[model samples]
Target: MQNFLKKLRFDDVPILDKASLYELLNQRFADEEKKLSQIPNPSLLHDAPKAAKKIADAIREGKKITLVGDYDVDGISSTAIMIDFFRQIPYPLEAIIPNRFSDGYGVSPNLLKRVNADLIITVDNGITAIEAAQVCKERGIELIITDHHTPLDTLPEAYAIVNPKLSTCSYPFQEICGAQVAWLLLGLLKKELNLNIDMREFLDILCIAIIADIMPLVDINRTLVKEGLKVLMSSQRPSSLIIKDFLNKSSITSEDIAFQIAPRINSAGRLEDASISLEFLTAASTNQAYKQFEKLNSLNERRREWEAETTNEAIKLVNSDDTIIVVAKEDWHEGVVGIVAARLVEHFSKPAIVLSINNGIAKGSARSIGNVNIYELIKQNGHLLTKFGGHKMAAGLGLDEQDIDAFRIAINESASKLNSDDFKSLDEVIGILPSSEIDIELLNLLESFEPYGEANSRPLFLIKDAQILETKTFGKESSHSKVTLRQFAHEKKSIELIQFKRVLDIPSEKKLTCSYRVVKNEFNSRVSAQLIINKTYNY
Candidate 1:
């Protein structure tokens, strides 16, 4: 018999029955009521009200307002939210998304030298743009910085700065994404100017940023995503509709945004300029949006090809005995290294860093598994790094090519001293349910906890002693399997289970235990519950 580990249990959370599980989940996972009202006053965020007033003054003075944004999903969404808001007020606003290759991550000196504006407002970035802030000051352009990244020791001397992570800020939730921070500032701006604007219209963009940036979906984020998903489903937004149609999704979910939409949007910034994605998000016409979507789709295909090629090369550099994996190669695409690092972590279950070498300089992205603080590890070796910044689980850095080997050794040594428990495989099973209990009703009930991501995840269930009646292989590469499963004791009731990217061999006589999730499969105007098998053990 295959050993089945009961990894997670809600014994501490009081639950009388299946009907009460929702309440239990809410009690345990949700920190506060997920309502718009639950969001704290925007003024509580450091300089948010000041930023709003600055923006209002700039509008009144008829100053040219330029928006500088980063080139990621969060940054693009933040820009889109601001553009959508400004459209209501009839302002001549110019938006710029810095090219990853040309202007680097944020508002750089290169960008400031070209921009001609009386006022510059940076969204999703600027918290780390110390030199750029100086450049803006020198150019006599009033600056407003709104971002969500962790601030450094000394903040930039901008006209007004809005970031919840600031030590002086009193916002209850500090984990919000960049778009949410921008949305909050816009909300304050709307109230200050008494502008008749429906702020809820921008929630869809906020939802995309929150999920795409991998923010923990709890507290206000949960509420925003919950309501945002509804708006997205009913939204006539040209880009949203085009993307939905492109993916052939009948209903939008958090997973759909994370897996389908975010990747395509990110591909533009990754392989090319992010303006394509920003244009797609803010496209006013269906034709324009569709054209942008097709372009992004093509870019995503190219990204996939590069990602696969780089991942293979990265894996070859990994040693079986290494606790931390660091690989560098000249001519590797800088944009795809982050994805390559993620794939390395997933495949090896270790913290990994992938660097692209150019002109004796190495630029790298790092990803961590378990509780490893990859950022801290990189920071500890700051002497060897030219630049580095990121959160605990992920980071980006630059270093001299000669320092790559030394940095790798130092990071691996640091990782080795950490707890071995961090490296252990942990199953994230929520609970077990009998095959008979799996139905559309249960799926609906479970979906009440919608907008799942990061901290708030979709539930995985274990089904034991299921008999496999039939199996078939599908997909273009014949790498997918469709198996009909039923309880051993209850043979009449069968469930169709789908497994992606993995071909399984199930003997006709052998019973299996499976870990799966219940998902609604829609086809030809009909919806039915289906099991998505994550893993299976035969006994």
Candidate 2:
């Protein structure tokens, strides 16, 4: 492990030695520091300031405000953030999240009709909700959209639009997700009102959303997480106590948020009720928050079971003929299908569509690999879909059962029209390594690449031929295997590298090449390093 990473570093790969690199990272971090100063953030377009003024006026006048949030964690967190911020002002506000089972995604026309509010703010979603916005317009309810999805050719006719992707908009970073948009709005509000509130308080919540939403952790996002983690570690955030008690970690990292907290936040919507997560995030007392946190933990465990089983079943249905992977199961829960689709795309190195069939209408989530654009692919075959919306890499759609075959052919056909080789050619498989390289210092450098998700992926290193020295299996059912490898490739240096979850499939006496990440493990009051295997091949 020690010699492996150094051997893997390439000339073209970015080095920290350059002044520009440090300058850029510093500037980006500074920009994040001063984010709150830019109230009525200049990045947003089309009456964002006007909408902020309206919201501020509503607060002063004590008018009722209803928040319409989407179904995902980003939406829920955005909802919770709004609720938390407003409650600080102690403003009169009510939050309404659309149900995935009942109201479906986006701001539902029915949901809007039922709510009585002078001002309605939509988070994580609403830019594409043309008809629903019209309903709000007709009912004399002012609508403000603070979404971060790709805009349509024609935007919704609403009171204000605040998406970064709009061509007319001047937002510097267009790639931010919806939760970030909500954070930006909050930043603007804090600045305009001359509020003395700590900016880092909101950033702690934002760190979770940033990681949970799988947005790129580059530029502004990198800074948000960098400073957000500071606030979290300092335990200064007033709103993160629920999350604090839930994990019970002495120190919080972005990885903790992504793997531990975000999933729990998301589990509510996936397994049962989204409101459980909202309640947990906004819980006032430690006891109340702990209860909700425990519930979310239970829901997350169940969600994992469902995801693992559903993905295994879906993989069996994938045919070798299709350029893309399309699999559906009627029994699959609609909420977790997106996650399953993402897993399939990652495992198979192909675009994947996981669908949940209900009432002859197949609701599906699509995830892509590399440069493949699932949204554009769906758009090209627009006639086959009842409705679809998303960015290039991900999308959601509804299709009729009768059109399944044609839909498959059309998507595959569209994929075939492009360079199929382009998708797989980028995939590189590397060798096994000596374990000594996985030291605390390198781990620190790798750890610096925090808040990893989506575009900013975790560092993956490759190692060449190492011989397996020992093998063992763990877990109640022996479901996981761990292997130790030995290598003395670099002269008088021999090291041990552990390959986890590979003992069952791998033979003990064999030479293998592997790719992995270095993770530090503390046991028996001692610290050592381990290699988390990514891909391996036996020789």
Candidate 3:
């Protein structure tokens, strides 16, 4: 655990003099507030108004409408938002989420064949559904696509398409997630149809999608999450309330969604059909929501089991000399490969792809580190792949079983050409703090930067030369450590520090330098400042 200190990079946040702390705080808050105030209008999104008008026309004409969504948290949340909005307008609508195994991803021809509707709207997917869009066109089904994925050179021929990343799109913020795009569409529809629906009702779930999809929490995203957290804690939504109860959490935070709620929602899609998650989010009553929550919770547990098994097997296949880790096995669960790939990336600090071999085809998930664009790398070897799509950090692909070795060799060669700095581990430190400065007042000031995620990460500070007063190990496996420390100038003031999944061997007589983040630990209705240790240097 202590070895992590050697990889630390304290360059991101310069150490500021104590006298300038207040000025720095004020400047950051002012900058964030200014960015929030300049959020762009949804009207700026290309084809948004056109899509809204088409949707309104279908509802007015009583044309049968079906929503086609992906099998992920973002897609499920997008489907729920649209379903809730349609219910308010008293419009009968049908929703369908693709099954990861049968339906593959996005709007497939098989999925489209199963649906019979005059108008088909796709959320969170359809940006790359060229053939599926052709099928819809031939079948005379009107298609309106609302997605946020990176677009290819030629877009599908749909009735209307709304995506911020479109080459023609002038929307100022292109990094918004799928659910936010759905929310924006609903905002326009509410106005075009003169509906009196409160858009804020959807933020609680929208916030989850934004964070779960790893969208940057800045500008409009920051506002959505900040406001969404308030709505989530109010417990007005049955789904949110049930999730909170299941997790035994008194209040919801960005961390809660990232680690707890999102995984449960995603588990359904990963293990079976994602429609279970959609049902959970859109359940009409508390009892129904609870039932769905229980089902999702069970699925999540199974997912964890499969993920652990696959991760161990994949790790065994990693070669130390390889620039990229590519592992494949027969009978491995396809649903858990993505999680396994991510774990490999974390453990090996390199790009990794885990494939599940079934019959003669290999379906895999790839995860990247630092500057490596996994999507671009996979696309570069497109000749060997049957299907591939995703962003820079992560991607999914399929290929012939025979090509696995060649594909692995190709990606590793590409990865080897990159600089070593791209694969180095660097811990971003905010600033240095003395024990005297560790108090509730400083923690409260840090709270101003709420809803931390991708871009706006939680602040981390380095505390130098702190003497350990006490130490203890806990948890089922005794893998967690709790310690009390004090600085030289403030020997009387001791602070509690916690390190999860790591058991530290520190002597009370020695002083250590620690990098940590300030967090508020709540217990029995009381909250206090606590330090979450990320790395410790024995000096």
Candidate 4:
């Protein structure tokens, strides 16, 4: 299944046997009004109006309008949104995505060396660019910052800073990704310029950013993703087409976005300069899109290699006694450390931070489990950290190499206050889908709630007490399998299940209970509902 995952979208874990899962789904369905009729006012975000007006004035004054962005998926998507919007206006624009290795994240002082513009706007980043903002002030550049990351005690000195996370912000939703901030800024910009541009024109890209950034899929985020995914499926953009063609499926789901699309877009940023992704998203033609698409695939492969290697080494250094896992090593690719942190959290079911050391400076990424605010944990030791900023679930930080041991001890000591129950992984299952009930109609019913992600994930159903009647193994190293199972409780109806990353040590008993997700299996031009095994249990 590991190799199959590499070849296709295979993502999952844990199970809960609960009847209230149905009630929860019912309540969610009854409250379809979660979809807002109108998006929240952009002016509600602190400084949005000021930033939009400043940008409009820049365009009218014929000032060199430059947009700066970060290198992550949210950052790349934000830059792509501005690129697409300006292109639609037929306006000449200069866009910059800081190189992770060279320019560092956001509009930093180092990145300022390459930035030359009269009016510069930052998207998805710049909330913490205190030094860079001071530089812009000293250099006579009009800087407008639009970011969603939580602001620190001292804010940047940009001319207009638009971020909903600002303490004074009255925006209805507080937990939006960076690209949302960027897109809303464009919405206000449209109003300021009195342009006929429809802001909905970019949700196809916006959806990708929201999912990739792991924003909670509820309220405005859900509304935007649902609408954006529809546009993405039907979008004529070369990038969208490239994705559909690559997946080879007519119906695109949020899982496809999370597992298949987002990774490829993020791979370039993780392993190389994010500008490669910026180019891919804004590809002008099919030829251009495919040309960049190939590069993304190559980079994605390399990212996987680096991530696996680092994860293996980091796992060996894990201290099982600690509440939080902090692993640091010399020469691990800084670009892949974040992913390594996530892998560690997944493996140990604990919060983790992985740092790569170079020249006596350690920089790395942090990933948290449920209810553990990793950003806050890292912030608790701010005096030890040279730099750090992010939200609850994830963050990045830098510190002197000598402080690694103390930082680790301090963070873990702080983590001791957290409830142990919060560390337990919950795999919510919509229990008992009889083999006979698994069909195209059932799959369609499940997919009606599109764009499943954080806070609103795709429902998993249990097929209990199934007898594994037959099995066939194939794929790389026989790591994939096709099995026929019968549920005696359902009059012995049989279903074909495809399991990826085959379990190494199943109980000797032939009877097994499995929790699985319904996926369309296309073989020999025939499409049918099939189960993708998430976890198998013998009880």
Per-candidate TM equals: 0.91, 0.88, 0.90, 0.92
Model 2 segments beyond 4 Å from truth?
A: 1-46, 236-239, 242-251, 420-434, 489-503, 507-509, 523-526
lDDT, each prediction: 0.83, 0.73, 0.84, 0.83
| Cα lDDT tens digits for candidate 2, 54-127 | 78877777888899997777888889889888877667689988878877887868777689988889999987
lDDT tens string, model 3, 1-539? 43554435433445555445556545544454534336677889999999999998888888999999988899999999999999999899899999999989989898987999999999999998999999998999999999988777778999989999898999998988889998998999999899999888888899999999988777788888888877887756889788767656555678779988899999999999998999999998989999998999899999998998888888998877788888999979988999899889878788899999999899989988877778888888888899887887778889999999999899888877778777754336667776677777776676766776776667778767677778899997898999887856636777788998789877565676788887777777787787898777654
**Best-to-worst TM-score order:** 4, 1, 3, 2
**Which residue runs of candidate 4 sit more than 4 Å off their true CA positions?**
1-23, 34-37, 463-466, 487-491, 536-539
Task: Flag clash pairs in model 4.
Answer: 1-479, 1-500, 1-501
> In angstroms, how far off is 31's CA in candidate 4?
4.0
1-539, model 1: which lDDT tens digit per residue?
11323322222222124665566557656344657877788788899988899899899989999999988899999999999999988788999999988888788888888899999999988887888899989989889999887777788889988988899989998988889999999999998889999888888788999999888788888888888877887789998778667767666889889988999999999999999999999999989999999999899999999999999888888876788899999989999999899889878778889999999999989988777878887877888898877777678899999999999888888887889877643435556666566777887877777877777677776766677778889998898999887765745787788998778877566576677877777888788787898777554
* Number of the predicted model whose TM-score against the real structure is largest: 4
Q: What is the lDDT of residue 425 in candidate 3?
A: 46
The lDDT, on a scale of 0 to 1, for candidate 3 is: 0.84
Roughly what TM-score does model 4 have, to 2 decimal places? 0.92
Q: Could you give the C-alpha RMSD of every candidate to the true structure, in order shown?
A: 3.3, 4.7, 3.2, 5.0
* Model 4 per-residue lDDT at 95: 95
The positional error of residue 458 in candidate 4, measured at the CA in angstroms, is 1.5
Q: Count the backbone clashes (under 3 Å) in each candidate.
A: 0, 12, 0, 3
